[model samples]
Every structure is written in structure tokens, then in C-alpha cells.
Target chain A: MRPFTVHTGTAAPLRRSNVDTDQIIPARFCVRSTRSGHADSLFADWRDDPGFVLNRPGHRGATVLVAGNDFGIGSSREYAVWALQDYGFRAVIAPRYGDIFRENSLLNGLLTVTVPIEAVEEIWAAVEADPAEPVTVDLERLQVRCAGNVTAFDLDPDVRERLLHGLDAIAMTLREEELIVRYEASRHPALPTTR
Target chain B: MGSTLAQKVWDSHVVHRVATGSDLIYVDLHLLHEVNTPQAFDGLRAAGRGVRRPDLTLGTEDHNTPTIGIDRPIRDLDGRRQSELMRRNCAEFGIPLHRLGDPGQGIVHVIGPEQGLSRPGMTIVCCDSHTTTHGAFGALAFGIGASQVEHVLATQTLQLRRFKDLDITVTGRLPDGVTAKDLVLALIATIGTAGGQGHVIEYRGAAVADLSMESRMTLCNMSVEAGARAGMVAPDATTLAYLRGRPGVPQGAAWDAAVRGWTALRSDPDARFDTSVVIDGAALHPYVSWGTNPAQSVPIGGRVPAPADFADPEESAAARRALDYMALQPGTPMRDVPIDTVFVGSCTNSRIEDLRATADVLRGRRVADGLHMMIVAGSAAVRRQAVAEGLDRVFAEAGADFRAAAGCSMCAALNEDRLQPGQRAASTTNRNFEGRQGKGARTHIVSPPVAAATAIAGRLAAPADL
Candidate 1:
């Protein structure tokens, strides 16, 4: 995972709320190949319409996605997060996110910043008014700034630390191997196997 | 202070806690399926780590296997590769795997409890979100992403945060026409999609206690629809009776000790929760989804909800979008909504009890002239039980298609079973997300009885309506 401290990029606004994982990347694309790029499959159904925001010329290279509340609502697949990163999105701003999706983002070093719905609307309006304007998301300071207006956001401290240090969870857990072994040994051998 | 069942199970599993971060909790049982395990195994190999506790981890090939053909090779290239990869990965890691031909092979969620592998007070994690179904036994079971799957495989633990407890108590006897599926649907409909976002809900009260183990499993299975990854009901006589003779269960003195432990796994009488909700079971009918999301539902007798019914602008807009995608009109009676196909199987409601319920309804009734109805059992064990009871013959004689049990068939269209464009289906699956069945296809989430009646009526009809 790449360490993420701060990133500045053009923002693309997705006005629809409850944009589920199925819409982020459909189940059809789920079978293509493991560990392959899914950029082309991102929002495949929605992209059928030429007017979809991401398909428009101005947002072609946008790297920050400002979407509505209740984003990533269904499915626990990390493919949705991988698709966003594959499409070059470094940060996603929403009023709320599905619990599992948010966790996946944290582990992969893709920054997910949560702001008030009003703040999200403001950013969307600003990005729509001027597509060329860049938004800076500073994780170190916990703020999202755009068009001379800035909004402070909140992130779980542990997740923020993971993103800041690019820590690998497996490596960290391995350090406590003895503890795990002892815990396993504590369970009575007379008990049935949990499997 | 007394602790809720969730807190008790969660606290018991803690291995190490960090002051600035979450605790590392030991995972007792890890379940695996084809869709999410392949990439996870790849990650484990790349990192040069073998499974820490292969005995505690079990693998089964689902989500990509064909329900119609068990003896033949998988025709879908991706499905075949995923299944093959899972076999190789499990073989190399020394994890016990139940293959397509194995009677124990079925949907991961189904076989876990049926085989008595999911015990009370245990911590279970699977790649599939519906793993919450195991929580019906008082275990703290939830789903995880592929990355978390790898984490559990390597360390036999998961990084975790405590979740708030929400006790949902359903009182009174369920109405004659309503089933446990309807009760869960009504709960989700009342509390919107994200209502239980950060909480673990416990289903209890008079109505919940009266339900059979299979019915209780159905209630816990759809907890994800309300944004809760885990749902629990304390184990009692109903749960113990269900597990008495199942495989992998302890025997004699061990059984007595196990029962004592499970008996103590309940929430204390004075335990407090973050939130408490009470539901009247008698008021619920056979509920069905009218829109793309599970929360967008109404009773079978109710009409479609207008966008204006939602107070929040975002929710209103979402409802409108769902209506558009579902091609449904506001104020239309749910019973009048026509369906092109009826699917009576999924991890949610594909057990022997579900088959028996559908079979009772279709024993002498004929499927509507031009409509198609399909029945797939939850597993080979379930299929065998159904066959011994002559449920398969009842389905075939009633003009419904009876197929073998495989992974996730129509629930997710990874196999040959799928709805085509512009087709609408009444399914017993958990999610009704856009194109969940197939591209341009719409799904109406229903229970098995409702699905069978809908097939016979050629529309969305409840068993009482017939």
C-alpha cells in the first residue's frame, strides 16, 4: 500500500446517493481476472449514458471523487475500492459510506474523508461551477479545501495512522504470534474443533 | 455492569489491544468461498505465508458452481478457473475443502451451522456477507473483504473495533400469512438501509423465541440488508436441538460442557444496549421489495410508495431512481406487480424447511401458463432430504423446474441461471441491487412461499391470496 499524506486533484461530482458496489463495478466484471485492472469496468452501466459525470470531458482526468451520502451501500467486495484506485482516484469524499467499504479503503491506503452533507454539496457546487479548479485533501491536517472554502473532516485515528505510515496489517499481526499461539492453546483440547 | 451477548463474545476473543488503535481478536472459525478466496490465496502466496490454522479454516466452492450440472465441468471459464484455483489453494495450504461432488459442499453459510461447525460464543468470519446467518446460534459471525480474509488466514486473528448493540425485539405471534422472512423485511423497511450501520442487532422477544432454528437463521441472514454485518439470537433449546446430532459436534461429557457454555451465552436480564426497538409481529404480512434496494419494500397488500413519502431529499431521489430502474409505478398494488420468473432458493431461504413450505403450496397447483419457476436446494444434504420427502416430484409435477444444489445460483448470476434483459424475477435472495440477477433484469425480494404463490398466480401474490 502507498502512503497517503496529502493529495490535490480535480474533483468529479457524483450527485446520486446510495451508489452501491454493484454500480461502482458491476458483478459481471467481477469475474474477469484476479488482480487485473478494473478501470474500464468502473460504473460500466452508468457510463452507457454519454452524459454521466465521469464520462464528460472536463472530469476525464479527475482524481478526487465527491459523491453524495450513503455511498458504497452494498456488497463487501474490495473490488469497488480497487476500481477507484485503478481509475487513478486517490481520495473519495462523501457524507457517509458503507462500513465495510470504508474499512477496505483504509487498508488499501485510499483516503476516504467524511464531511457534513452540506459540505459535500458545497464542494459539488464548486467543482461543477469550475471543473478546472483543484481540491486539496490534507489528511495530516484533516481538511478538504476548494474554491477558497475549506471544511474540516474526521477520520478514525487508527486508520489515519495506517494511511500515514503505509503499515502492513499482516506484518503487524505476526509480531504477536506468540500471543496468538497462547490464546489458541488456552481453549480446552476437550472441546470440539471450531471448524 | 452486565454485558450484552455481542459484547461478551467480542470481549472473550480479544488477544491484544493497542492504546491508539483497535484490538487484535482471535478468529475461531474462518469460512471460505470461491469468489473472495482466490485473490486472498494469491496474496498469501505472494507474501510467503502459509495458513496459520488450516484446521480452523474450511473452504467450499460456491458463488461460481453450476446448479444444473454437478458431474460436468463448469462451462463458464471464469467460474471454472476460480473453482480450480480454490481447490489448488486449499490443497497446498492443507485446509479442508468440500468440493462440488461432496455432500457437505454447499453454500458456506448453510453448511456451517448444518454441520455443527458454527457454535455459540464462537467468532466466525467468511468472505460472504451473509455469514451473519451463523449468528443465529449466538456466535459473533460477520463477513470480511478479501484483504481481511488473508489477514485471518495468516494470523488466525482480525483487527477489530467494538460495535454498538441494538436489540430488536419482536413480540406476539406472527400472523398466519407472514413468515420470519416477512418479519425481517418489515424490520429493514421500517429502519432504512443504513439505520443499523454501526451496530450489531440482536433479534429477540416472544416471537423470536417461538421460531424454529431454520426460521431464526432466515431472520439473521438478512441483517446485512440494514447495513449490519452481524446479527445474533441467543442459543436456546431450539438451537441445541438443531445441533444435537450434526457433524463436528462434541459428544458425551464434552456435549454437556458445550451446552453449559452455550446456556450462559445469553444477554443478562439487566444488560443495557445502545438502542432498543420493539416490533409487533402480528402487523406484518408477506413483505416484498418494490425497488432496487431491500429497504424499498411494502407488505404484499400495500401499494408502491411515492417518492414524496421520503422526507430527506437524497432518500426521495434514491427512491425515484429505484422506481425508474425497477419500472414500477407509485400507488400500484404490490400483488398486481407481474413477474417473469420466480426463484425459490438462496442462502437466505434454501433449506429443507423452505423447500417443504414451497412444496406444500405447490403440491396440487399448476404454475401459471407462461411463467417459469425454478427451485434449487441449499445444498446436497438439503436436496437429499427434499428428495426423500418427495418435494422434488411435487415441484416437477407442478410445472416448476427442479435443479441440483450448487453455490449461489440465481441469487447471483455467476452460473448459467440468470434472468435476461427486461425480465423481472421474484427471488428469495438477500439483495435487490440493480442487475443483481442479470444485466437489465429486475429482482423482487420475496420468501419461498411468496415466490411459489407468485409463480402460480403469474404475479406477486401471497399464499393467502391463492
Candidate 2:
């Protein structure tokens, strides 16, 4: 995972709410064992329509997505995050996000910014007015800057620290090997074990 | 302060605590299914890592497995490769898997509880969002992503950020014809989709206590749809009865001791919660979603709501778009809406009790002409139980297709069991998102009884209506 510190990229405005993972990468496209090819299937259901925002002229190479409330609302599939990253999106800015989707994005290095609806509206306005308007997401500052406006966002400090460095949470977890082994020794005997 | 049930389970599992941010909690059980998880195994191999505790992990073939014609090799190339990879991966890791055609093989969530892998006071994580289903036994369970799955596979632990506690009290007995599905749908409607954001909900009160173990599982399974981190009901006699003599349950004296311990796992009366919601359960009717999202629903006897009925601009816009996609007219009675298909299966409501409820409704009835109905069980155990009770005969005689094997038949369109472009279905699945059943299928989420009743009426109708 590449560390996400500060990124400035062109924006694509998606004026839709509850944009679930199913639509991000449909179930049919989720078959492949690998994760990279999802870029082609991103929004596979909607891309056929010429009027879809991603297909619009100026938004072609966007690396930031500004969407409505409740983004990534369904399915725990991390493929949704991979699809966005595969499509060159460094981050996603939304008013709200599904709890699981937010965690998935953090672990996979896709920055999920939870800004106020007003800030989301402001960013969308800026992108619609000028499709190539640069949006800056500063993880170090916990802020988003676009069109001369600075909007603050909130992320758990631990998550921010982990993202600042490319995290290996499993390795970090393994550092407490002694504690884990002790706890396991005393765990309930009634618990199920595949062994 | 008095500790809540969620707090008790969470605090008990902490192997190590970080200074001010998170806790390294021990995971008791890690369930795996064959979808979106192949990458996790690939990562483990690349890093030269082996599973830390294969004893605590179990895998199954569910999400993408074929429900019918499964006796032969899986016909779909993609589905076959996934199953093969799952068999090989579990074998390589030395983890036990309930493979295809195995008696224990079924939906991961369903078989876990049936085989007693999901019991009280344990911390369980799976890659599927419906993992909250195990919380019915008072366990702390939630879904994780691919990276977290790998984290659990490699270390058997998860770095956790805390969630605020939400206490949802459902008082009074549920009305007749109202099942757990309807009760949960009602709760989600009261609290919008994002209402439970970043909170763990502990469902309690007389109404919840009266529910069966399977009903409690149904309630917890859809907690994710309401945007909750997880949902739980404290273990009780009902939970004990369900776990007695199941596969992993301890024997005789050991079981008694386990019961004594689980009996103590409950929220104190004075427990403090960040938020509270109270619902009068007796007043809830059989709910059926009219639009795309689960919250966009109303009582069975009510009419479809107009967009103007919503005060929030975003909700109003969403309602309008939902109506357009649903092809439904405002002011139309819900019972008047026609459905071309009826599907009764999913992690949400595919247990034996759910199947029994569907069978009770369709016993002497026939599916209406021109309607396609498929009744899939949650597990082979559930399927066999249904057969012993003659529910399969009831379904077949009613012109409904009772599946031979248990898998996620049509809840998702992972295989050939899906609707065509523009077909509308009254489904018991947890989701009704656009194209969920298939490419252009519109789904109205309902309970098992409601699904069976709608199948016979050829429209959205409650059993009482019939």
C-alpha cells in the first residue's frame, strides 16, 4: 500500500446518494481472482449511458470523486475500493459512508474523506463549474482544499497515523505475540476449533 | 458505570490495549466464504505467511456456488475456479472447509450457527457483511474487508477502533403476521439507513426476549442494512436451547458450566448508552419495501409515498429516483403492486424456521399463474429438516421450485439463478438495491410469509389478506 499523505488531483462530481458497492463493481465483474482489472468494470452497469459523469469529456482522467451522502453503503467487498483506486482515484469525498466501507478504504489505502454536506456541495459546485479544478486532500492536516475554500474533515487519529505510513496492521498486531498466546491459553475450552 | 453486553464482550477479548486509540482484540472465530477473498490467500502466500490459528478458522462455499445441478462439476468457469481455489487454499492452510456437496456446506452464516461454531461470548469476523447474524448468541461479530480478513488469517486478531453504543428497546409483543423481517424493516424505516452509523446496537426488551433464536438471528443479520457496526441480543435460555448438543457445543457438565457463564453476559439495567431508540413493536405491520433502499418502505396496507412527503431535500430526491426505477406510482396501494417472481432465501431468512413459515403459508395454496417462485434453504441441514417435515412436497405441489442443494440461490445473481432485464420480484433477501437480483430486476424486500403470500396472490399481499 502506498502511503497517502497529501494528494492533489482533478475531480469528478457524482451527484448521487447511497452509491453502494454493488454499483461500484457489479457482482458479475467480481469473479476474477485478481483485483486490478476492476478499472474497466467500475460502474459497469451505468457506463453504457453516454450521459454518465465518468464518461463526460472533462472528467475522463479524474483522480478524485466527489459524491453525495452515504457513499459505499452496501456490501463489504473491498473490490469497490480497488475499483476506484484502479481508475486512478486517490481519494473519495462524501458526506457519509458505510461503516464497513470506511474501514475497507483505510486498510486498502483509499482515502475516504467525510466532509459536511455543505463542503461536499461546494466541492461538487467547483468541479461542475470547472471539471479540471484541483482538489487537495491533506491527510496530515485533516483538511480538503478546493476552489480557494478549505473544509475540515475528521478521521480517527490512529487511522490517520497508520495511513501516513503504508500500514502492515497484521505485523503490528503480531508485535504483541506474548499477549496473544497468554490470552489463548486461558480462552474458554468450549470454543470451536477446526483442529 | 454499568457495562453493556457489547462492552462486556469487547472488553473480555482485549489481548493488548494501545495507549489511547485502539485495542488488539483476540478473535475467537474467523469464518470464510468463496467470494472476494481469493486475494487474501494470495497475499498470505506472497508474504511467506501461514495461518496463525487454522483451528479458529473455517471456510465454506456459498456466495457463488450453484444451488441446482451442483452434483456435476460447476458449469460456470468463474464459479468453478473460485470453488477450486477455495478447496486448494483451505487444504494448503490445513483449515477445515465445508466444501461443495458436503452435508455441512451451506451459506457461511447459516451453517456457523447450525454447527455451533457461532456461540455466545466469542468475537467472530467474516468477510461477508451479514456476519452480525451470529450476534444472536450474544457474540461480538462484524464484517471485515479483504485486508482485515488477511489480518485475521495471519494473526487471528484485529486492530479495532471503538464504536459508540446504541440501545434499541422494542417493547410489547409483535402483532400477528409480523415476523423478525418486518420488525427489522420497521426499525430501519424509523431510523434512516445512516441512523445507526458508527454505533453498536444492543436489542433488548420484552418483544425481543419473546423472539425465537432464529428470529433473533434474522434481526441481527440485517443490522448492516441500517448502517450499524453490529447488533446483539444477550444470551438467554432461548439461546441455550438452540446450542445444546450442536456440533461444537461442550458435553454434559462442560455445557452446564458454559451455560452458567453465558447467563451472566447481559447489560446491567443501569448501563449508559450514547443513544437510545424505543419502538412499540405491537403496532408494526408486515413491511414491504416500495423503493430501492430498505428504509423506503411502509406498512402492507399503506400506499406508496410521494416524494413531497419527505422533508429533507436529499431524501425527497432519492424517493423520486427510487420511484422512477421501481416503476411505481405515488398513491398506489402496496397490495396492488404486481410481482413477476417470488424468492425466499438469503442469510437473512433462510433458516429452518424461515422455511417452515414459508411452507405454512403455501401449504394448500398454489402459486398464481405466470409467477416464478424459488424456495432455497440456507444449509443442507435446513434443507433436510424441511424435507423431513414434508415442506418440499408442499412447495412442489404449489408449483414452486424447491432446490436440491442449499446455497445463495437468487438472493444475489452470482450464478444462473437470477431475474432477467426488467423483471420485478418480491424477495426475502436483505437487499433491494437496483439490479441486485439481476441486471435490471426490481426487488421489494419482504418476510418469508409475505413472500409466500405474494407468490400465491401474484401481487404484494400479506398472509392475512389471503
Candidate 3:
């Protein structure tokens, strides 16, 4: 994972709420033995239709996806985030994200930005007007700015730190191994014997 | 100041707190499956570690093996290799293994509760996220990754952080047609799929209190949908009754003492939560997902939402995209969405009760033409019970495909069974993600009755419609 700071790129409009992992990378894409090379498969069916936003010529190179509420719902597959990253998306702006997907995204260094529904709409309209127009998502300020407007929201500091540093939950836990060992030593005189 | 279920479980299991704010927590039960066990076994082997406690660890083959004809060797070489690897790993590590033909061979989640290995006030971990299903028995259960699996295998312990506190209380009696499946769908619809993130949800209130053990498992099985760490219902008479005389549960005087300890596991009356949501069960109706996500759902009688009406612009766009993917017209009644397939069975609703429910709908009826319907049981045990009860005959008579048991079948298209491209299906499985049933397969989440009814109509329909 890279440690580059995320700058919101062009906003690609995705109008639906609760965009599940399945749609992000259908299960067929998951059958591959290797995890890499899923970018082309992201939304393969939908992207084929010329009407799909991602397929629309104007939206080419859009890295920031502006989506509806409750995005990324369904299955705990980490592949969803992998596909999004492979597709060149650095940030997903929505009213909310599926919990597991969000955790996976943050762990993999994908930024999930949440803003008020009203602000999300404004951003959506701005992107729809000109799909090529860029939206700036500033991690330092915890805000999304585009079309002469800026909206700020809260992100759990722990998550922010993890994403900024490209650290996953396991890596974070491992980093504090010394503390964990000491804690274990103090809690039980002897580890409980398993049956 | 208030303790969440996660906090309560975390506190009780903490052996020591280190100055760096991490803790070493004891793990009570470790569930293993073929897909994730090989790597852990290799790690253990490389580390020169023997199985720390074989009795506490349990393994089963579900992900890689075919659901049908356990006697035959797996035709998929990759799958066969994975299964064989697990067998070898377990043998080398001295862990108990339940191969495809074993009586205990089933979904790890289902086998744990059925055999009474999943009990109240225990901490269980598995490589599968749905391990939260064990929490139905009042245990603290969650999924860990392959590395964590190896660590736990070697040490019988896990390092962890606590989650936030949240309680979703569904009060009052559920209406006659509503099952635990309906209740969970309603909850997901109301809270959105991400509502439970970073939290361990405790299902409380009168309605939850009234559910049976099987029903409780259905409720907790989908906790992953809500982004919850786990969902637990405190043990009561219903839980104890379900566990009594089970193959692995306590017997004699120990049973009495176990019950006493289990009884005290409930939240105190004064216990508070950082976040609380109250649901009136009476208002809920059978729900089905109209779009790609579980939260993008409506009541059986409701219509698909128009993208223009959305309050959020991004949501409006998403609605349009989902409408396109699902091939649904705006403002069309969701009940009118045509379905080409109906699937009943998965870890979510493939138990004996689920089979019985589908059978109730299929009895004396036939599935409509052009509709492909299949029933896959969660386990061989469930299949045998369904056979003994003649549910298979009813399913066959109704023209439904009564196939042998398999994991990730129609639910995920891991096997040969799948929805054709551009075809829509009504499934009882946990997810309706894009292509979850197959590449280009559109899934509409539905209950067993709805799935059966849709099978009969060749489109989405209610059970009463028949």
C-alpha cells in the first residue's frame, strides 16, 4: 500500500444508494486465483452499456465517485475495495458506506468520505453538469470541495491515521505487539488450557 | 459509561491490559474451514508449532466441496486440492477434521450450533465472517483473517480492540406472516446497511425476546450486513431448551450449573447503550431488495423508488444505476418485478425451518413455466431431515429443482448452478450483490415464502397471491 495523500479527482456521479460489493466486482471476477487485475472487471456489465456514467466518454479519468446513501452494502469481500482501487478511484463520497467495506477500504488506503445528503446532491449535480470537472477531496481538511462549494465532515481519527499510513487492522495490531504481550502477561498467571 | 455487548464480552475475556492500550483476550472456540486453514497450517508448520489445543479447534469442508454426492471425489481439481490440503494440514497439526462424508460436515456456522459446541458466554472465532451466527447462542463470536487464524491456532488467544455500543430493540409481537427473516430485512432497510458499523448490536425488546433459537440464528446470521461486529441475544429458556440433550452440551449436574451461568448473561435492566434504536415489529412487512444492496429494499407491496425523488444527488444517480442494472422501471410496483429464478437455502435461511416454510408454499402447487427454482440445504443433516419429513417430495412435485446440499451454490454461484446473464432471481441468501448469483445475475432478496411464491409465478409475488 502506498502512503500518498488522497486528492479528490474528477467526481463521477453514481446515483444509487446501497451500491453493494457484488456490483463493484461481481463474483465471477473473484474466481481468479490472483487478486490483481480487476480494474477492467469493475462494473463490467453496467460499464458495457454506453449510458452508464463510468462508460460515458466525459467521465473517463474521474477518480472521485460521488454516490448516494448507504453505499458499499453487502458481503464482506475485500475485493470491492481492491476493484475500486484498481479502477483508479482514490475516494468514494457518499452519505454512508457499508461497514465492512469501509473498514476494508480504509485498511487498503481507499478514502471513504461522508457528507450530508444535501451536500452530496449538490456535488452530484455539479458532476452531472460536467462529468470531466474535478472535485477536490482534501484529507488534511477532511472536506470535499467542488463547483465553488466546500463541505466538511467527521472521520474517526483512528481510521484516518490508518488510511494515511496505509496500515490495516492486523498491521496496526502487530505494531503494538509489545504492549499486547505485556497485557497478556499481567492478565493471567497461566494461559487457560484449551480442552 | 454504558457497556455494549462488545465491551461486555471484551472485558470478560481480557487477561491483561498493556500500557500501549492493547489487550490479550482468550479465545474459547476456534472454527476452521478448508479455504482458510491451509495457510494457517503452513504458518504453524513453519513456526514449529503443534496444535495448542485440538479439542478447542474444529474443522469442516464447506467452501471447496460440492454439496451433492459426498462419496464421489471432487471434479474441480482446485477445489479437490484445497480440500485435500485441509485434510493433510489437520492431520499434521493434530486437529479434528470433518471431511465431506463426515456426519458433522456442514457449514461451520450451522454445525457449531447444531452440535451444541456453540454455547452461551463463550468467545468463538473463525475465518468466516458469518461466525457471528454463533452469537445467537449468547457467545461472543467474530471472524478473523488467515494470519489471525494461525496466531490463534498457535496461542489460543487474540489481540483486540473494543467496538462502540449499540442496541436495536424490536418490541411487540411480530405479525402472523412475519418471520425472523422479515424482521432482519426490515431492520436493515430502516437502519441502512452501514448503520451498525463499529458496533456490536444486541437484539432486545419483546419481539426479539420471543424468537426461537433457530429464528435467533437467522437474525444474527446477517449481522455482517449491518457492518456489525456481531449480534447477540441473551440466553433464556428458549436457548437452554434448544441446547439441552444436544450431542455436545453439558449433562447431569453440570447442565444445571451451566443454566445458572447462562441465565445471568442478559443485560441488566439498567444497562444503557451509547446508541439505541427502537423498532415496532407491527409496522414491518415482508421485505425484498429492489436494487443491488440489502438496504435498497422495500416492503413486498411497495414500488421501486424514482431516482428523481431522491434527496441526495448521488443517491438519485445510484437509483438510476440500480434501476438500470436490475432492469426495473421507475415507480413500478416491486411486486411486479419479474423473476426468472427462486432460490431457497444458504447459511442465512437453509435450515430445517426454512425448508419447511418453502414446502408449505410448494405443497399442492407447481412452479410456473419459464421459472427456474432450486432448493439447496445448508447441510446433509438438514437434507436428511427434509427427506424424512417428505419435504423433498413436495419440492419435486412443485417442479422445483431439489438438488443435493452445497455451499455458495445459487447463493453465490460457486458451483455450476447459477442465474443466466440478464436473468433476475429471488433468493433467500444474505446478499443480492451484483452478479452474486452469477455473472450478470440480478438478485432480489426475498423471504422463503416470497421466494417460493415467486417461483410459482415466474415473477416476484407474495405467498398469499397463490
Candidate 4:
């Protein structure tokens, strides 16, 4: 995972609530042995429709997905985040995200920005007016700014730190391994026997 | 400050809480499945490590095996290789395996509970997220990744940070038609899918207390949907009664002592929770997801929401997208949404009880023309019981497609059973995410009776219609 700060690229409006992982990366595409090749398959069915937002020629390189409320629900498939990353999306701006998907995304280094529903609408409107205009997601300030409008949201401090550092849950746990080892030794004198 | 279930389980297992804020928690039971076990086995092989406690570890083939044919070789090479790998890994590591052809073979979640491996106050870990289903027996169960699987296999312990407690109490008697499925769906819909994030939810109150063991499993099975770490029900007579004389549960004097310990596992009368949500069971109706997410649900009689009614334009747009994907028209009654298929099996609702419920609704009825209905039992044991009770005959007589054995069939398209592209299904499975049934397959999460009724009506029909 890269450690660069996220600056939301041009916003592409996709007004859909509850955009589940299955829609993000269909189950068939998930059959790949390696997890990295799913980007091209992201929204495979929907992308074929000329009317789909991501398929529209003008929105080709848009890196920020401006979506509606209750996005990324369904299975805890990590491939959904991988597909979004493969599609070149650095951030997903929605009012809320499916709990498991949100955690999966954050753990995998995909930026899930939760703005208020009003703020989400404002950005959606801005993107709708001009699909090429960019929305800036300042990681340091934890704010989203677009078309002279600004909104800030809270991220659990631990999750925010892990995202900024591009560390996974395992890595975060491993960082405290020494302390864990010492604590285990002291607390479980019979640890070897259990093993 | 009184202890919560999460705290009680965590405290009992914690070797130590270090200054760096990590603890070594002892793991009692480790469950493994094909999809994620290969890498863990490889890691162990590479490190020259043997499974620390093979007796405590259990393996089953579910995710990659073909649900249709147990005696024949899997035609899907990839699926076959995954299953083969689990077989070899388990054999090499001396871990007990419930292979596809064995009567013990079934979904790991179902097998563990039915075999008496999932006992109260135990800490269980598996490679699959739905492992929380074991928490129904009052154990602390959750999914871990492949690396963690290897870690547990080698060390028999997990490093962890404990979670806060959230008590979600559902009071009052459930309405006649409502089941545990409705209660969980209602809870997720009320709280939104992320409402239980970072919390270990303990299902309490009259309605939850009265649920059957199988029903409780269905409730805890979807805890991941709410982003909860796990969900547990304190063991009571209902739990003890279910465990008594099971294949592996303690016997005689040991059983009495086990019950004594389990009885004290409940939250103290004055126990406080970090967060609390109260629900009225009477208000819950059989729910169906109109959109992709479990939270995007409404009562059977409700209409799909019109985008324009949303306060946020973005939310409106999202609703529009979900409708487009689901092929549903806004403001349309959900009952009117035509379904091409009805599936009544999954870890969520494929037990003997669930099968019996579906049979009850399907008796003397036939699936409507053009609808493809499938009933896949959760395990061989469940299938055996259904057969003995002649439930399979009822399903067959109703024109519903019935399979002989069990695996995670239709619930996910991991095997031969799948929905054709653009197909719509009413499924008893937990998720209704787009393509969950197959590529471009649209699913509506429903209860067993609703699934059976929809199969009969050839659309999204209510149980009351029967």
C-alpha cells in the first residue's frame, strides 16, 4: 500500500445508496487466484451500459466517487476495495458506508470519507454541473473541499492513523508484538503447557 | 463498570494486557475452511511448524466444493484444487477434517454447533466471517484472516484488542409470523448496517430469550452485517437443552458442572452497556431488501422509497442507482417485484428448523410457473433429518428443486447452483447484494416462509399470502 496523502481527483457523480460489494465487484470476477486483477471487472455489467456514470466518456479518469448514503453494504469482500483502487478511485465520498465494507476499505488503504448527507448532496450537485471539476480531500486536515465549499468529518482516530500510515490491522497489531509477548509471559506461566 | 459479555469472555481468555495495549487471548477452538486455509498451511510448512494443538482445530470443505455431487470429482479444477489442498493440509497437520463425502461434512459454522464443539464461554476463531454464528451458544466467536489462522495454528492464541459492549434488547413477544430472521433484519434496518461497529452485541430481552437454538444462530450469523465483532446470547436452559447428549458435549457429571458455569455467564442484573438499543418485536414484520444492502429494507407491505423523498439529493441518486441495479421502480410495492428464483438455504437459515418452516409453507402448494426454486440443506445431518421427516418429499411435490446433500449452495455461487445473469431471487440467505447469487444475479433477503411463498407466487410474495 502506498503512503501518499489522498487528494480527491475529479468527482464523478454516481447517485446510488447501498452500492454493495457485489455491484462494486461482481462475484464472478472474484474467482481470480490473485486479488489484484479485479479492477477491469469492477462494475462489469453496469459499465457496459453507455448510460452508466463510470462508462460515460467524460468521466473516464475521475478518481473520486461521489455517491449517496449507505454505500458499500453486503458481503465483507475485500475485492470491492481492490477493484475501486484498480479503477483508480482513491476516495469514496458518501454519507455513510456499510460497516464491514468501510472497515475493509480502511484496512486496505482505500479512503472512505463520510460527509453529512447535505454535504454529499452539495458535492453531487457540483459534480453534476461539471463532471470534470475536482474535489480536494485533504488527508492532513481531514476535510473535503470542492467549488469553494468545505466539509469536515470525523474518523476514528485509530482508523485514521492506520489509513494515513497505510498499515493493515495485522501490521498495527504486530507493532505492539513485543509488549504482547511480555504480557503473555507474565500472565500465563503455563502458556507452554497449553501450547 | 459491571462486566459485559465481551469483557467477561475477553478477561477470562486474556493472558495479559500489555502497556502497548495488546493482549494475548487464548483460543479454545479453531475452525478452518478451504478458501483461506491453503496459505496458512503453506506458511506453517515454510516455517517448519506443526499445528500446536491439532485436537483443538477442526477443518471442513465448503467454500470451494461443488454442492451437487459428493461422490464425483469436482469438475471445476480450481474448486477441486482448493478442496484437495484442505484435505492434504489437514492430513499433514493431523487436524480433524470433515471432507465433502463424510457425514461430518457441512458448513463449518453448522458443523461446529451441531457436533457440540461450540460450547458456552469458549473463544472460537475461524477463517470465515460468519463464524459469529457459534456465538449463539454463548461462545465468543469471530473470523480471522489466513495469517491469523496460521498464527493460531502455531501458537493456539491470538493477539487482540477487546471491544466495547452494546446490548441490543428486543422486548415483547414477536408477532405470530415474525421469526428471528425478522428480528435481525429489523435491527439492522433500524440501526443501519454500521450501527454495531466495533461493538460486541449481546442479544437480550424476552423475544431473543425465547428463540430456538437454530433461530439464535440465524440472529448471530448476520452480526457481521452490522459490523459487530460478534454477537452472543447468554446460555440458558434452552442452550443447555440443545447441547445435552450431542455428539461432543460434556456428559453426566461434566454436563452438570458445565451448566453451572454457563448459568453464571449472563450479564449481571445491574450490568451497564456502552450503547443500548431497545426494539419492540411486535413492530417487526417480515422484511425484504428493496435495494442492495441489508439495511435498505422495508416491511413486506411497504413500497420502495422514491429518490425525491430523500433529504439529500445524493441519497436520492443512490436510491435511484440501487433501484436501477435491482430493476425496481421507486414507490412500487416490494411485493410486486417479480422474482425468478427462490432459495431456501444458507448458513443463516438452512437448519432443520428452517427447512421444516419452508416445508410447512410449501405443503400442498406448487411453485409458480417460470420460477426456479431450490432448497439446499445446510448439512448432511439436516438433509437426513429432513428426509426422515419427509420434508424433502414436500419440497419435491411443491415443484421446488431439491438437492440431496449440503454445502454453501445457492447462498453464494461458489458451487454449481447459481442464478442466471439478470435473474432475481428471494433468498433466505443473509445478503441481497448484487450478483451474490451469481454474476448479475439480484437477491432479496427474506425469511424461509417468505422464500417458500415467493416460490409459489413466482414473485416476492408474503408468507401471509399462503
Tens digits of per-residue lDDT for model 1, B1-466: 8999999999899998867757889988899988867888889999999999998898887787888767899887877888898899999999999998898989888889888888889999998778889999999998888899999999999987788899999999998868889999999999887877878999999999999999988999988788886999999999889989888687898899889988999898989999888999877789999988898889999998999999988889989999998999999999989988999888899999999999989989999998999988888899999999999899999999988765678887878888998899999888898988988899999999999999999999988889
User: What is candidate 4's lDDT per residue for B10-62, written digit by digit as tens?
Assistant: 88887546555667787888988777567668767777777867877888877
* Cα lDDT, all candidates: 0.88, 0.91, 0.77, 0.80
Better of 1 and 4 by lDDT: 1
lDDT score, candidate 1, position B320: 93
Q: What TM-score would chain B of candidate 2 score versus the native chain B?
A: 0.99
Clashing pairs in 2: none
lDDT score for residue B7 of model 4? 77
TM-score-superior candidate, 2 or 3: 2
For model 4 chain B, the run of ten residues with the poorest summed lDDT: B15-24
Leading candidate by DockQ: 2
Q: List, residue by residue over A36-114, the lDDT tens digit for candidate 4.
A: 6677888886887799998887788999998876677655556677789888988889987765567566656778898
Taking all chains together, each candidate's TM-score versus the true structure is 0.98, 0.99, 0.83, 0.85
Cα lDDT tens digits for candidate 2, B45-123: 9989999999999999888888888878877797788888889999999999998789999999999999988988899
**Count of backbone clashes, every candidate in sequence:** 0, 0, 13, 4
True contacts kept of each: 0.54, 0.74, 0.25, 0.18
What DockQ score does model 1 reach against the true complex? 0.63
